[model samples]
Target: METPPQRNANMAQIFHRSTNFISRFSLFAGIFLAGLALTGVLGLARSPYFTRQNVTRSQPVQFSHKHHVGDDGIDCRYCHTSVETSATAGIPQTKTCMSCHSVLFNNVGYLEPIRESYRTDASIEWVKVHRLADYVYFNHSIHVSKGVGCSTCHGRVDQMPLMFQANTLLMQWCLDCHRNTEMALRPLDKVYDMAWRPAANQAEIGRQYKAERNIRNTSELSSCSTCHR
Candidate 1:
């Protein structure tokens, strides 16, 4: 029998060409998707919503941290009273500002909101600068007690006329600090000092504090459960 004049060679060649085209197309598609994904990630990282640098929101009163903390030498705990005792750092009430501005700048135009809030017995709606996700459980009291200074996380508020977020407040950033806590640890007395710097023997001091406080290992501190749970 003639058997259809030997068609196997041509059929095999067509099948091979089709598969090659599909493989090439798939490779190109994968590369395109990877590039797009990388660009998106980079854009998000640099966006104002993520970086949060120099991003200030207008509040009921235009309070300047530089004026209050830097020029006036006000302690952070004075306004954020719960920083040392709670997971959330509480916002200052109108009474807190009136404690000083009541007599100092009571008639000033900028102080009108403060005066109004105080008179109305309503809390001043101070805009939050540093905020974390609800899922992330960060305890300011624990961080403060562990010798992490305010500046270690909050940055130099004393120098900021309008407070803005300094750190990214991302999980990776927290993990980095947790992995290397010594770099941020300070004397417990200097927890509120925003301009504190590491002294000559700061590392040794940090080690001593870590031992005294029985800080967990880096692996424990960087665990997902540490923040997520």
Candidate 2:
């Protein structure tokens, strides 16, 4: 009355015994490769080729911050006039260079560009070393007023034979300072001092300066609009 269902000889196993292991190994290998690819992309993004850190830029005139700030002890404000009062650190006009070079090295062969620019009332095409993305908005005055020194972001310019990007200038780098800003504060008088260092009690001093200056909190400083807008 009951005919037992007979297995068909042609019906073979759809999967091999090793199929499970192969499937699992394939999944793991794909995941590992994906992770490796992501890591490589992230590393490349932060590398000097992308960030331009420590890479010296060629300039129209071979101006040396070392000679100006180190050898001659010239102040930063002499060239960057608007640093204290404006969003931009204003580039020095040809006249500013003429103020010194007119007498100091007026006849020098290399000084001809300065003379030509001044004579023609045209600006010297000085290549900018520190450049932020166009979408980023940075103010020199605000940072200076808060006791953030020039060398804090610019590095030891007095020691550089040619100006280069000392830091990565990445969003993460800015966020690091914004998150722990007190550590970067100094006396207002020392804002331009390239060699200024914190004393043994700098932590205490920085907190005091932070309070006195009423610097914004980390949340505000690190907010998207702070730099982006």
Best by lDDT: 2
Model 1's TM-score against the true structure: 0.83
Expressed as tens digits, the lDDT of each residue in 93-196 for candidate 1 is: 77888898878967889788888887888777777777777898889899988889888887888998887888888777888889988777887888888778
Which tens-of-lDDT digit does each residue in 176-205 have in candidate 2?
999988899998989999999878888788
Cα lDDT, all candidates? 0.84, 0.92
Give stretches of model 1 more than 4 Å off: 1-30, 42-46
lDDT of 1 at 102: 76
Best by TM-score: 2
Which ranges in model 2 have alpha carbons more than 4 Å from their true place?
Answer: 1-22
